[model samples]
Target: MDHYAFTLVNGVFEDKVRTDPNNRKPPTLIRQPQLGLKSYFDGTSNPCDKNIPQPWDRLRDYVDVLNRESNEGAKYKVIFVLRHGYSLHNYIEKGVKKVNEAGEEVKNDWRKGLKFAYQKEVSLEALRGAGCEIPRVLEDHLREGDPNAAARVSLYDAALLPKEIALQIRGSEVTNNDAEGLGEQWLRWVAEDEFPLPGAIYTSPLRRCLETTKKVYGPVFAANPKKHKFQPIIMENLREKGNGDACNYRSTTKYILDKYPNYMPEPDFTESDEYEYQIQRAENGEPTESDEELEERMRKVLKDIFDDDKTSVVSLTTHSFSIGALTKVLGNARILDEGDITAFLVKAVPL
Candidate 1:
């Protein structure tokens, strides 16, 4: 079976490393348990086996293949991972009232002391007076319950409304829109200098990430028209962390608790099992396992990619949480900090 090894470093992949000869730095080998009979086969086993191979053996075989096939001449192939650009959610928190089926106000658990219906009506009127066209669908959704209604309104329709009201809301901000410049720089660095681009590009499903990818890649494809044949793969594994219901209490309360330690009431002097249960649920990937699930999903995607010798060079654009999980699964110590990019390179070898 063909062995493969890969490492992600600073947004570039190093498929094969050279020994200094005079000062040889032996190749690093990583080995872990194989789940079944494949464990006894040694590092060179059939790739088609359905059983899980030890992680270390997988890594060693990956590297060994590159060494043999290239006669020691192969350079590592880098894969870039990055977070999407900035967005309005970072700046302001605006509230809209939720209305029941009867069009009556329904108080949100997270937002207390605010009228559930009147606030949105007043805000909509204010926006209309300021030259915004409040979409009936958006208003209806706000009155009802729609997960992506807020995002859609903020991105495409907010501009039609009042500047002051819009100013109070948050929007995504792209640093640069020139795709050609970014693509040129990336190509030059990767092809000529053999250096990885400073960062990988990963984005959330939101409009901001899509916009960022379009702008950054536009110029690169423009300059090298042929390379335009390749496009990024959007993986659900790279999505944001918030997921809750209409009460709004789930995500917001957690955020508040994390931010202002003293805001919530002190733990009751009499602790109950329920208290521990709640805590455990919060810590045990409750509310949303999107990040963890994404990591495992990405691992499978990569495993398949490594199995194919013809596949070389690819990019993944996704969100922060997904990137963090991916980095950890790849053996990195911590999650990716905001706006950071990480790269990796994989090598294939005949074990």
Candidate 2:
């Protein structure tokens, strides 16, 4: 696992271990099996060795386990914009390393592209297909470049499951199993110690977001909506940015209602159609949407979502790419990984 250390002078976070001259190693991560604890590195070539313990002297040598649990990351995020947890489709994509204005590494809320194996880190060569096919996109996405160009795998070729089901890794078929341990992440980020109760929830109509809505916050809202001012609403525009089969295709409202009876759909919202034109274009290798068009629609969607409610706090469930659009609309945000929730406070700049 990747060990991390933080410089906290008097219980306040300062900088990551590698970035600080005083610390040599990060603190060790902690886990519990009864709670179904699992790390993002669970299925990779190398994962956390739970038997190991961090001695006080060597605390820095261990990965910073307390960081994720302390609600420290929560202080920065107020408007919770959550990405669905790991999915079968994320295999080819990796994390995007980013630096903030201060030039320090800004850890993604979801820790995308995180590799946990200590010395036995999974190598690209090891991930080669049975047919000796190098996962070119996965390779490029991990290695670093313009992500949009390098991070694509045809849904058909990837042999991925439906977008809504929890991703299974290796041979584990557990649904919403949080293969990357995102459930634990959600628990930390949304708990009272971290974020405030949401006033509303706006979700993508796709199965993954829908499933996430149930898995992540269902307990809080389902038990008592009035107390939290939480109401889950489905919006067609919240789906990923595409007119293609993947973005356009979705489960019927009846199917969703059957699964999550409490979810409320936008009025006048009806069935969805997989755009035949877009699908055909995709089949023939056409881009889903131009940057200009995508941004325009995203801005429109953001307008509707903001106009829908004036709640001080709200939770939004959507996909990765769309989250970029959200970042554009909301000042600035870190790149999101699956099942990652980024909460931030917002102030309206009246137009």
Q: Kindly state the number of residue pairs that clash in model 2.
A: 22
The list of candidate 1 runs beyond 4 A from truth reads 1-77, 93-205, 228-230, 241-286, 307-309, 333-340, 346-351
Q: Residues 1-351, candidate 2, lDDT per residue (tens digit)?
A: 111111111111111111223342222112222111122222212233446442211222122332233333311112567776555345432222211222223322222223211111234443332112333443454445564543333332122233333232322533333523544544553452333456678888777788777667866554555557445798877777663434335677887788778889988778644433343333333445664565565566655645566554567888766776655554442345456555433333224
Q: Can you write out model 1's per-residue Cα lDDT over 163-229, one digit (the tens) per residue? A: 2323333234222212333445555544554332222233333344444455455455445554333
Q: Which stretches of candidate 2 lie over 4 Å from their true place?
A: 1-78, 92-194, 222-226, 274-284
Predicted structure with the largest lDDT when compared to the true one:
2
The TM-score that candidate 2 achieves is: 0.52
Q: List lDDT for all candidates, in order.
A: 0.37, 0.46
Per-model TM-score versus the true fold: 0.42, 0.52
